[model samples]
Target: MPHTLFIADLHLSAGRPDITAAFLRFMAEEAPKADALYVLGDLFEFSIGDDEQSPLNRRVASAFRDCGVPVFFIHGNRDFMVGRRFAREAGLTLLPEHQVIDLYGEPTLIMHGDTLCTDDAGYQRYRRITRLGWLQWLFLRLPLKKRLGIADGIRGKSAEAKQDKSITIMDVNQGEVARQMRKAGVRRLIHGHTHRPAIHRFDLHGQPVQRIVLGDWYTQGSVLVVTPETETLQGLSLGENR
Candidate 1:
């Protein structure tokens, strides 16, 4: 069967070499067998810049280059800084924040999923400001060391803020989700960010619709497998599916 793969929130970094290794292993094994690979978002915990020359960054790019599959990446809140240079080097196709794709005949809306969390007023406000193109350009123009330091401060504050936010506030809002679906005219939505993985089935104006949330890579490798006949989310132990 021809199947496509979707993943998100791996948050890969030097500190998490185990996760990186697991992901690389997957790219070498499962990814090459897929029709294509879609990295929905947050491939990194925090991406400083495309100009970064870390071994961790290079290794990941190399894996994708060798995967033998067309790779697609959507900018996530954590890795919104991933630019064209890195995409070219990694042989990745960069996708917009909100994208609609034909998934084996289904019109699916794909996102990094942060925009669906309308309840998080603070994060939404921060998102709007930080994503300004000119602002990002200015920030990236700074020395890599400085950019990393600023990213650390921001990530630290984001972590602390999450500690204070209720689970409901951090998760996607049902109304916003419906609105997005309506706007996109899509009955199926797939995304990852909240680290909560599940299939949500609901009715949209008396019609059936589904939302698929991808899992984080903190514990197991999370993947959403889609084929002409089925859509399933699976968690993988480094080398095998469990």
Candidate 2:
């Protein structure tokens, strides 16, 4: 039975050796078994630019190259700077912010899910600025040291902002999610960003729809497996590695 795997919010960095070890294990032991793999976003804690080619990034790229499956990556809020260079090195196909595809014969919409957090006006404004072509080009031209400093500053501010924000504002907005689903003409939506993993079934314009949220890999690994007849969310425990 052919099946597809979806994951997101790994936020992989050099500091988290435990998570990194788990991810390497996953690529070697689990991902190769899937027909295709979709990484919705935040694959890294922060990607200053593709040119850095840090040791950690190189390791991840090598792992992806050896995964033995078609891998696709969507830019997340944290790692939106992941460009073509990185994708090519990692042997991954880069996807747009929102992509609609036929999944086992069903129309499915996949995204990084940040755009759906409309209630967080501040974050949305930041997203708009960072996504601008001119601004991104200018940012990328800075020296590697400067780029890293800026990323660290921005990350610090983001951390502080989250402390002041309510959970509801950080999560996806229902209306925005529905609007995106309608635009994509999909009854099933798969996304990651909020880091809250759950299956949501609702009625949209009298039609039944479902939304699946993928969790972060901060504490454990979360994955969604979809086949012709079934869709399931499974968590891989870090304790198992002990």
Candidate 3:
């Protein structure tokens, strides 16, 4: 059976040795057999532009390339610095957020889900600033050591902010999700970011809509697997059943 696999919110960093190992194992053992693999985003804790690829990034990219299966990626807030050259080098295609693709004839839209952070005005402002093209270009030109230093500093600050926030303020806004679904003209939405994993079926404008959320690689792991007979999701841990 041909199967499509999806994962996200890994937040892999040079510092996070466990996650790096887990990710490599996934690529080597599982991903190659899939018909397609979609990395929704945040695979990296921080990507300091395209000019300097971290050792972890290089290894991960090589793994995907060697998988001999189609690999698609979309930038998340954390790794938005990923560019076209990196994608080409990794033998992966860059997928646009808010894109609709036919999945076994079912029209499905995919996103990183950060745009649903409409309720969090402050974070949205910060997102806009960091995503600027010129700013990213300037940052990419710096030395790798300097870039690493900056990324470390930024990660520390982000961790502190998350600790200070309430859960409600950090999650996606339901209203925004509905609006996006309507705009996309799709009844199915798949995204990763909130680290809350589940398949949600809801009523939208008198129609049935489904939203699938991919979880984090922190506690355990979550993957969406779609085949002809069934569309299933698996949540696995280090020693858990796959």
Candidate 4:
């Protein structure tokens, strides 16, 4: 079984106990069944803790470490500070922003899609500063308590930023999507950031392609499963049947 997986927007935080349980269950059951797992972005609510010994982080990482498959992670706005330490501890491969790979014999591109928010100049500018190497280094050097405080402050600020942004500015622009699709020479674009889960079929240069938006895993469970024999995108809620 060739399984190329995609999940995003977990936003796992110490505040959400049920989500933590569900995620643990996922690793214990669901993850093992897959040949590979691609966590699109936002695996944590905000992880800047210096303690590699944190119980929560270690527990989550251990699940993947024992899953017996490849686990790939991409950085999202919330958990962008996830560093090499976490990756090494969790036994995950950190994927770059624009990663082109072959899955199931088809060319595919994976991203967090924050760059697609070209219309949101303010947010884009913020992304630039946070991603800066010097800024990250300075931020990480702070004490664990201070880092946690900073993470909390940033989270609150992000909520404010979202409130001020327009819907169109936040979502991916169609033209930009088309341009990237053409450039990558792959019709498939899979990402998760806007928390809108849908499988979009579009015609580009007379060729049909798919743009998959992965949903947030909070009250509902969603995953995009792509394999040679089975390819389907669906949402799973508590009351819904599988």
Clashes of each: 0, 0, 0, 0
Deviation from native of the Cα of residue 236 in model 3, angstroms: 2.7
TM-score of each: 0.97, 0.97, 0.94, 0.93
Q: What pairs collide in candidate 4?
A: none
Tens digit per residue, CA lDDT, model 3, 1-242: 88899999999877677777777778888898898999999988888877776687788879888988999998999999888888988999998867888888888899899988787788898899998889888888888899989998998898998998888988889999999999989988999999989889999999998999999988777889988656688876644322
Across 161-190, the per-residue lDDT of candidate 2 in tens digits comes to 999999999999999998999999999999
lDDT of 4 at 76: 91
Candidate 3 residues lying further than 4 Å off, grouped into runs, are: 239-242
Stronger candidate by lDDT (3 vs 4): 3
Model 2 lDDT at residue 8:
98
Model 2: colliding residue pairs: none
- Poorly placed runs, candidate 4 (over 4 Å): 49-52, 237-242
lDDT of 1 by residue, 88-169 (tens): 9899999999999999889999999999999999999999999998999899899999998999999899889989999999
